[model samples]
Target: MKKGFILIEMAIVVAILGILLSISYINFTRLSVKSNVDSKADEIASMLRDTYENGNKEMNFKDYYIEIIKNGNSFEVSLISHKNSVRKTDLKDFELNIVGQTFESSPKYIYFSPNGEVFLSNEKIEEGYDYNIDDKKFSDIVIKKGEKISKKIHIDDMPLGNITVD
Candidate 1:
């Protein structure tokens, strides 16, 4: 009788272990994907900062494009290619939670300057950053001096593609 009771206890323990292992495996897979996406965002941010540093004064604003996308919990940043080619390496990085839906709107922008600034519509401005409050117009972000600069062009009509900034 004692042997029989021990055998039943072992069976129950094995079942619980199997359940725990399955849950852990599922969670691990999800976490891995989320981490990869987050890491990509960080890379993109760094590239933008570098671009601003390199060309705030010397290069033409038309030469570069910065694209940001908010998809649920994941985000992607990329540089618009010169020929409008969407190369995998051209994508800056993936970010997580850069913009929340609670905010007034989502912005996918390009920054012409090394300071990581872009020209956005007045209605899109929410908090922080600089803008013309009265007219709802935003001037280009300057690192030190104030100037009217243009950086973003809206192409929402185009679907998400190499040239599209949606």
Candidate 2:
């Protein structure tokens, strides 16, 4: 019955605190990763929507091309009227499923028409292909940070694409 904690009691208290801190740190790391992945997914989905809207609304640009490059974990957008930009993200290894087709190494393209439609393609879009796309189509863009964390963005088959994140 001492007035202060003995050596063994102090050691036990320190051990318990260390364990709790370790657990909290691990959980915090996991949550941070999840947050990063989710935000990256949302950014990609929003980029697609913005590209479509900009293409349709801007009268000067004949067409806007959004080319996805998985190697760089980035996408570049270009317009016929010389407007071009690129977006780079921290996430990588995106699994893009378009019309049941998987795009891995090769690049993919989603071009918007001033006519108010969006189309996906494997090759670089050409002038002739602008108006050749049929009715709207559905596509999925899966953004992944690693093996464990991921988010799915669905682009529905509607004019200008109806995008949803899950």
Candidate 3:
């Protein structure tokens, strides 16, 4: 009398476990990518805020790139580290995403009038005028998991003009 399954039955169970494990692994990888992208977006936003606060007023958007690299469970942002004034991390192949660009038809850049009010309809950069961080400089960068790595992030602010950044 046998109390256990046959060898053939055990082999079938092993195959089923293998399939399940593979599926779980694939799902985990996808989730990891989503998490990494979100973290990168938040980090970039913080950096922009800090730059704005430092009185670094420039009408032109500072072009920057975001790199995602493989190392371990955690991901890192690659850039020139200010303190060390050197490349922050030695990275392998990464997908570069563009961060800043000002469009003519877009209100991505807001100028301030002489009276300290935000010039609503002006398109040209005024002389001696600086960027007001309070004006809410927007970005259009988007990060996602899979083939589409980046896209313009848009937000609707109308009946007022929309807030957009890239």
Candidate 4:
């Protein structure tokens, strides 16, 4: 017959709500980190694909290369256009990092042939040099010739690892 809950009931309700909110906040943070990682990977892949497609056009017969450089916990991906001094510029450059993720390989320099083939400067995709984002043990990230650019996330828990490029 009570019109309002007693103090004990109100406290219990507040506690339950707090617990639910904490859980939701944790999940949200985890998803946010995963989303950020996925977004960065997708951006890199897109840039690579664009470079490959544009190189295939043979516009002015210029050479295009995607340069991956690692400095400390961060890495950068840049599109280098080899042509006239004025025309030579970085099409896209990005510096990103995920707390504890490490790159199990060294810096990679991928060249895009005018014929749309993707390969390293050595003309071959080097093994044991794939990027390991989030330390999920993911491998084989070389962009193969005539293959679509794609990446997958391997996050299974919260607090993703920092990135390290060898």
Per-model TM-score versus the true fold: 0.45, 0.73, 0.47, 0.55
Report the number of the highest-TM-score candidate: 2
Alpha-carbon local distance difference test for all models: 0.40, 0.63, 0.40, 0.45
Query: Residue by residue across 24-103, what tens digits does model 3's lDDT show?
Result: 99889877765565555555444434323222333222222223343543334443222221223321233333244322
Name the 10 consecutive residues with the lowest summed lDDT in model 4.
Answer: 84-93
Error at 157, model 4, angstroms: 33
Q: Cα deviation of 13 in candidate 1 (Å)?
A: 2.2
Mark the regions of model 2 whose C-alpha exceeds 4 Å error after superposition: 58-62, 72-83, 93-99, 112-119, 130-137, 158-160
Q: Ranking under TM-score, best-scoring first?
A: 2, 4, 3, 1
TM-score of 1: 0.45
| Model 1 segments more than 4 A misplaced | 1-6, 68-77, 84-108, 113-116, 120-166
Q: Per-residue lDDT of 79-161 in model 2, one digit per residue for the tens?
A: 32233565544344444445555566456667665565556677765454446666434467666665877788876665445
Ten-residue stretch with the least lDDT total in model 1:
141-150
For each candidate, C-alpha RMSD in Å? 13.4, 3.8, 9.6, 12.5
lDDT of 1 by residue, 71-139 (tens): 554344555544252422322232222221121344455443223334333132223435332332122
